[model samples]
Target: MGRYKSFLRQRYRAILGYTGLICLISGLVIISPLLALLAYPEELPLAWGFLVPGAILGLVGLGLWQLLAPKKATSLTLQEGSVIVVLAWLVAILVGTVPFMTIQGLNFTQAMFESTSGWTTTGLSVVDVTKASRLILLYRSIIELFGGAGLAIITLSAIAGPVGSGLTSAEGRSEQLAPNVRRSAKLVLAIYTGYNIVGTIALKLAGMGWFDAVNHAFAALSTGGFSTHPESIGYWDNAVLEIVTIVLMFAGGLNFVTAYLLLKGNFKSVVRNGEIRFQALMVPLCSLVILFGVAIGLYPQLGKAIRVSIFETVTCFSTTGFATVGYTEWSSIGWLMLILMMLVGGGAGSTSGGIKQLRVYILYRSLRWEIRRMLMPTRSVTEPSIWQGERRHFLQDDQIRQIGIFVFLYLILFCIGSAIVAAHGYSLQESLFEYASTMGTVGVSVGVTSADAAPTLLWTQILGMFLGRLEFFTVFVGLVRLLRDTRPILT
Candidate 1:
């Protein structure tokens, strides 16, 4: 009984320590939206929208900090780490909705949907962008910036020691940018910030105004897909701007390690990357499938068809959520190809979300190797291997099994979400498309999701976005931990 009490005390202290740190970080981040009001002095009175909430969070965080100060070296268990991450995200979404809630005609539910969508980088919007204020637009863009950098990477860097590696992994990252967690965090921030700067300048040169350029840069590079305009990329109709966006989105979808390599001037390593090669092969191939279908009857103009085909293919493949045209207007064959691209999303370790290209490559290679083994003589021995960057790794049964399970769960969630949407009186095709977009974290809408969407469907998509962004395992583990810890209360 004494030992059990000690265990509970330790766990409670850990929660307070970690959760307090997260609140402090979130409190500081919450104040960033107020900068938008500053940028537009005419909206000065709107400052209280962020200021009130930011002050409350900041005070709460400071109180926790003083109340549960750490004593000595502390270690976080796997369960604690996962739960902390889950809690942090939930808090961020809840706090992020404050500004949206302050706006008229938007309620708590709509505010939460938008907040989750932005922080998850899902890019879906419940409110119309054209009708939103400049401060609101900037706040929306800034949240995507936060999501792209990842709150875990930012906050964990300050306090994560030997035990903190698991914290980063909980956020779905495997690579350590540096041996020291802090240095690794700084390196990642530098690269992410650099891309935003370059992408913004490139877009401005391509004929976008300063305000639009900054927001679009944040969205495209994060694969967040939030647009300042109602028509999205189609709003400008500038081929140069579209091309520039395509390039930035493609870059964003590539693994961050690939970006690090380029920054380090290792071109050869990038060229040999398995995910890079697979992406190169799939983009044009998928576009051709779309082009062929659209060219036959849907779009008679060759130029228009080719342009739309490439844009949508890249958009879906990258999971960037930007649409040049309404995909529902395309043929069934085109929709299939686009949906397939969403399933086989961008590379692992990228801002883009989905099953990820690495897993797809592994599955494909494993199947081919299996075929060869079946045709070989009974005694013949064969081993399957994959090339990632310059390293070669022989396929292990365990690794393949894990990949298979992740992909399976992802699809299972997609199907379940789609069924729920269909229950609300939408067609299967429409339900599947929107749910796939939600579960894949790809933000394309088929008009089913809106301010008027059923609350059930809204909550369903929220679950999909949260699960999809965390990639299932973290949330699953977190839930298991929560139940296990609550046994005393249940009794």
Candidate 2:
């Protein structure tokens, strides 16, 4: 009982500290956006509201700080670590919503959905952002910025260290780059921030206005894809801007760890990386196929078609839904490819979301291995494989099963979401696209999602954003762990 009390106390204190820090940071984010809003017409005083909330939150955090402070844990369990992760994000979403709610007069539910979408880097927007105040616009970008930085991750780095030797072991990350998670978190954050800065500059130089540059940078680096203009990057009509976004989004979709390694001049390591190789092979091949489909079938002009093809491919792979053209209007084959891209997603540990290329690579590789084993049972003791090198670790039955389970659950959720939207009398295509957008956390749509959308469908979009952002499993495991913790233990 005493030990349990200690663990509870320690975790409670950590949550408070992290929450406070996020609130403090969120306050600063609110201010920046407010300053930006001053340049706009509304002249809404959104910053004042954030002031009170920020102050109250900081004080509460300060109070929480002194009460449940920690020295060390007797031990850390997977349950405890995961509990921390889940609670951390929940608090982040709640706190992050304040700016949105205060500015938009949104109900609690709508506010939460908007905030979660931004913080998750899902890029879905509920309110009409074009006429909205600068503060709100800036607030949206800040949400993407911090979210891409990983709210829990940033907070955790400030409040705790490696969590202990066991924390790293449980999380399935190697300490190959850093001695502790604090270092790793900082490294990733630095790279994330740097990427945004560089992307912003690149976009500005590519003829985007400073305002568009910053917001797009926030979206791109986060792989969130929220745009200041309604038409997104397409609003610019500049090929140079597309090139800039493609580079940033592609880089953003890659594993941050590998990006870190590359930063340290570990070029050879990235070259040999399993995920990198698969992503490298997939992008160009997908682009070529998409280009072929567009040129021969979809468009009358070749140059125009190729531009559309490359843009869609980049948008799909980067999981950045900044569209230059509506592929949804193209042939059935083209839309099908976009659908596949949303499902496949970007790389693991990237700002982007999806099943992640690594899992897909692993699943198919394992499939090939099993097939080869069956065909040559008498010829060898082992199975033939589709992948070699670092990803060999993914060949295990458990890994394959895990990947299959996630992919299946993701699809199931997508279907459930579609059905929910369909229940609202939306067309099948609209329903499916809504589901895809929600699951991929990609914001593109066939125009079904809106304030006018049936409330039931709205609710589905809300939950879809939640499921998509957490990508299902985190919520699943967290809920199961909570259930187990609350249940009576049998002797």
Candidate that would win on lDDT: 1
* Deviation from native of the Cα of residue 20 in model 2, angstroms: 5.0
Model 1 Cα lDDT, one tens digit per residue, 126-219:
9888788877887787778878778777766666354456667778876766777667777777888999999999999999998899999999
lDDT of 2 by residue, 149-230 (tens): 6654565456553555323322323332465666776777788878988999999999998888998899988888888887
Give lDDT: candidate 2, residue 333. Answer: 66
For model 2, the run of ten residues with the poorest summed lDDT = 166-175
Instruction: Give candidate 1's error at residue 193 in angstroms.
Output: 0.7
Name model 2 segments beyond 4 Å from true.
1-32, 35-44, 72-76, 165-176, 295-299, 383-394, 483-491
TM, every model? 0.94, 0.88
Q: At residue 357, give the lDDT of candidate 2.
A: 82
Kindly provide the TM-score of model 2 when superposed on the true structure, using C-alpha atoms.
0.88
lDDT of each: 0.82, 0.70
